[model samples]
Target chain A: MARQLYELCGTDPARVFSPFCWRSRFALAHKGLDFESIPWRFTETERLAFAKHDKVPVLVDGARVVPDSFAIARYLDEAYPERPSLMHGRAHAYRFIQSWTGTVFHAALIRLIVSDVPPLLDEKARSYFIESRQQRFGMKLAEVTRDREARLPEFRAMLSPLRDAVLAQPFLGGDAPDYADHVVMGAFMWARGTSPLRLLAEDDPVWSWRERLLDAYGGIARATPRAEA
Target chain B: MARQLYELCGTDPARVFSPFCWRSRFALAHKGLDFESIPWRFTETERLAFAKHDKVPVLVDGARVVPDSFAIARYLDEAYPERPSLMHGRAHAYRFIQSWTGTVFHAALIRLIVSDVPPLLDEKARSYFIESRQQRFGMKLAEVTRDREARLPEFRAMLSPLRDAVLAQPFLGGDAPDYADHVVMGAFMWARGTSPLRLLAEDDPVWSWRERLLDAYGGIARATPRAEA
Candidate 1:
């Protein structure tokens, strides 16, 4: 899936950066695979724009449209099996990370939604953010608005398990980055890159992993088109 | 994991049957596998009970404990790869089903929580239901009264995509039942067996699937023992 998507639209005819596209692009680069990231954007009125889901992180591989970061990450593991495995040997741990990345990161990402500066966060950003949040948290955003202030402590505490793991090993899987590391890092990167979530990494070893990973991907990354629905 | 949990429990002990356990038990039968159901009364004091998550349909396979209908069903698929693949050939469809079972059913399950028998209602159950709503809507139980009235329409709409697929095949996958069917049916069975949800099944093919599956599981269907955390 990753290979197919990469084969199609992952490359840029002219290279500029798209951070959302950087998730897969980084994964590919992490595996040292050759691929291109064709950055795509949208204006509210553009019918054929890549942001059909109104999200930046869609991957179009050949004819296949892969949406959602979890799906793209899984595609990377399956398509590039011979390259370093994201899962490595710990299947249960891998599944745990996958579940966490898909669900739990919403809190971190929400901080990004309120931010300004990203060119993508234009006039439609507020409406688009609400729509995406609705699709994700349901039409009721308040349902998800757990007191971020109160919950931050507990949420911050939860990362200790991962921090302990990363501190023990160079990567989440030990010695090398695995699926757990990449997926978690991809989420952490996005959250940190675009939102107040960057504060999460302050004075933490997890931040080191993030910095090294982004650096390995050649610093700032580009966006890829959201896969066609 | 299913076999492992079954073996660990000895399957000889418990005798209470709730709608949730039946889903997992029924799936085993549909696949022609043998197992035991130890009935559990979901209560706050029972740390091992589905009450922990304010949900039923928890399955125990050997020493390993699997929570969430989707996780348990998928674990079963992984543990027993033979028989038939529960997820059809389309990966996205299987994922779509899994996601619905996880997310949409979560909303639907909230309705059943409020509608169950009075004797079965416990502190944990009440807290989870009310708190989830409060957290989501900032409203109290007085605001969103019954489960059926509040969430059934949304539940039915969500199931529409799978309606035809379920009818064309004896199970969600094909002529044979698979993990997808079990996960979905298990969740539905919980509702059908317990609350007012049984009446709502008449209009949908999913209801028929539930009936057919429960009938197949027959005598072997018993309550799973309350788990200890």
Candidate 2:
């Protein structure tokens, strides 16, 4: 079978938004690999039963099936040693950044953009998303982001590590983009595809870094449909 | 000239405590190199005029004068490539962790331990430390840490990234400690050398991780003279 990747998307299949899925998408582009994008949606666990995984961003390359974005990146590196490395055989070294993105970055981001996501989903997925996230936050989505504009400074302050790293180098992986960059840029892609919030100031170095990634790899991320113009 | 590392210390020269200095010390130990410890005090800027830099951890490696902990790590790896790799030829990849340690980890730690540091310094250094730190925080050192006990939970919560990474692997560099581990453990060493504060609870995963580092490299960190028992 042709190489295939199951990516999470919204009602419009072109609106691929999940941060985890974006990591895999960027990894594929970085390795110069082509794959068929299988648009997966929320509340579609049954659809992923074949992979024994409920999440999207599942990679099925020939006889191999990788379920997680990190796994996919590792698999790509191992399977295609000739391609540019994602983790540079130091996969564990990237864990700190991944942990920061998952726990800290995503936590702050969801508070700012959670209310903006439901409208992009289908009725069933919308209901599921709202219910699950509301239970998680113990509050309505609107209330979670009630003072998001004022909270922007706090959120931005939380990004000091990322800002400092990118300011010192062109990418988190150093002179060029690496899996670390992909992991962080994935969060930005989530905000871009689902929310029109100006999460970053135009003068911020992070804004320039994101702009570089958007235009990278034949403008793959740039071509993706977003909620904003 | 014999290899020498000018490390920051307090009244007692053996009580080397600067976080950046510990990074170079740990990096040196990891590389299996030996060096004479040249104790540097807080008010000893003029003493380092030879390096054209005003900082502790100025590594004098033969004819090469390298200042800064990160630069020292890179210099060690480049000069002694056959010994072991610190950055594994991905020095840039390590920037994110260093930035996190410098900006986030160090920032939170100082607030909790600032008051504990003054007593460790000499009269001159203590005067300089109190005045400088007070200016930076816009409050007296003791006032800055007045409610530190109540803020323990907040401080611990900030370590989610480090805790999660260690829980997933034996070290930040996976099965072995790397420059990343050295960078973070350096901070804990700072606390150990200057504060009586129980920064990490005995049962916390981070506590265990710190214990492992304390015992690593032939118990060099463990053998160090700390303020705590």
Candidate 3:
């Protein structure tokens, strides 16, 4: 069985965007492993029944199946021990970082760029995305991101820890990208693929760090399709 | 040149409460090193002149003087490499977690507990603390803590990352505590030593984690004097 990763995308399969999928994708690239991308869209639970999960970042590596970005990253590190380590055998230390990125960083991000996402999806996924998201937020899709420009400063302020760390070191993992870097940069990938609100200022260290990650691994992330604001 | 740690104290010498000093204290305890505590009060810059720092966490280890808490932790790991590793040779990976604790976690905490601190000091130190803190906050200390009870929910919400992490693993460093634990627990030490505002609810995972740390290293942190609210 060939290794394959299911990634969430829009109408154009070339544009992979889900933050969780980007984490798994970066983890694979960091481990120097090559896998084919299977573009999975929203509301495609039936397509993932083989994995017994409905997540986009489902990894089918030979006979073993893995779901969830964090689980897949750990699996990659364990399976490919000879490769450059993503967790470096301290995977548990990253659990807080993962939680912060998911609950705090990514939570702040969606409010700023969520409305920009629907148009990139196909008609069925677009409708499903809008309805599900609106129900989740208990508001109209546009209302969730209203006055986003005005709220950008607060969102950036929420990233004070990341900004300070990036300014002091090249990456959160330091000297090189690790699972910590993948966790954060995945959010940036989501922003890059879907939104054009210009999340980071030109002078910000995080912006520079993002540029470095985009150029990493032969510029795989940089080559992805971006939606202009 | 006996090893001595200059720790911030109030009217009672046992009431060492500086958050940064607690980081150094915990780091020292984690390394299983013995050091005498030199109680230093506010407005005692002349006492720290030898270290060329205006902080309380001055570690005079034999002929060497280390000032900052972060620096002292690094110095401890380097000075005693054979001891249980505090950073596990990845000090750089801790920068973001440290920044987050310092800026986001500690910043939120001081607002709830600053007013509770004045009564702990001597007359001169109390006056000095009041003037300096009021100048910093641009308000009376009491005003800074006015309705602190009402803000407890917001403060607890700010701890979502820590709570989630502790629930998943026994410590931020996994099975055992490390510098990451010291950095965050230092903030809790500050609260415990100075105020009894009940920062964490009895059932909070962070509360249990704090209990474990308090019992760690022969109950050094638990032995400190606390100001009941």
Among these predictions, the greatest TM-score belongs to 2
Cand. 2 Cα-lDDT: 0.93
Rank candidates, TM-score, best first. 2, 3, 1
TM-score of chain A of each: 0.61, 0.98, 0.98
**Model 3 — interface RMS deviation?**
0.7
Docking verdict class for candidate 3:
high
Q: What is candidate 2's lDDT per residue for B22-136, written digit by digit as tens?
A: 9999999999999999989888999999999998889998999999999999999999999878999888988999999999999999999999888889999999999999999
* lDDT digits (tens) for residues A144-178 of candidate 2: 99999999999999999999999999999888898
Q: What is the full ranking by DockQ, best candidate first? A: 2, 3, 1
lDDT of 2 at A1: 85
Candidate 2: misplaced stretches above 4 Å?
none
Candidate 2 accuracy as TM-score? 0.99
> What is candidate 1's CA lDDT for residue B133?
60
Judging by DockQ against the true structure, name the best candidate.
Answer: 2
Q: What is the lDDT of residue B207 in candidate 3?
A: 93
Clashes of 1: 28
CA lDDT scores, all candidates in order: 0.49, 0.93, 0.92
Error of 1 at A74 (Å): 8.3
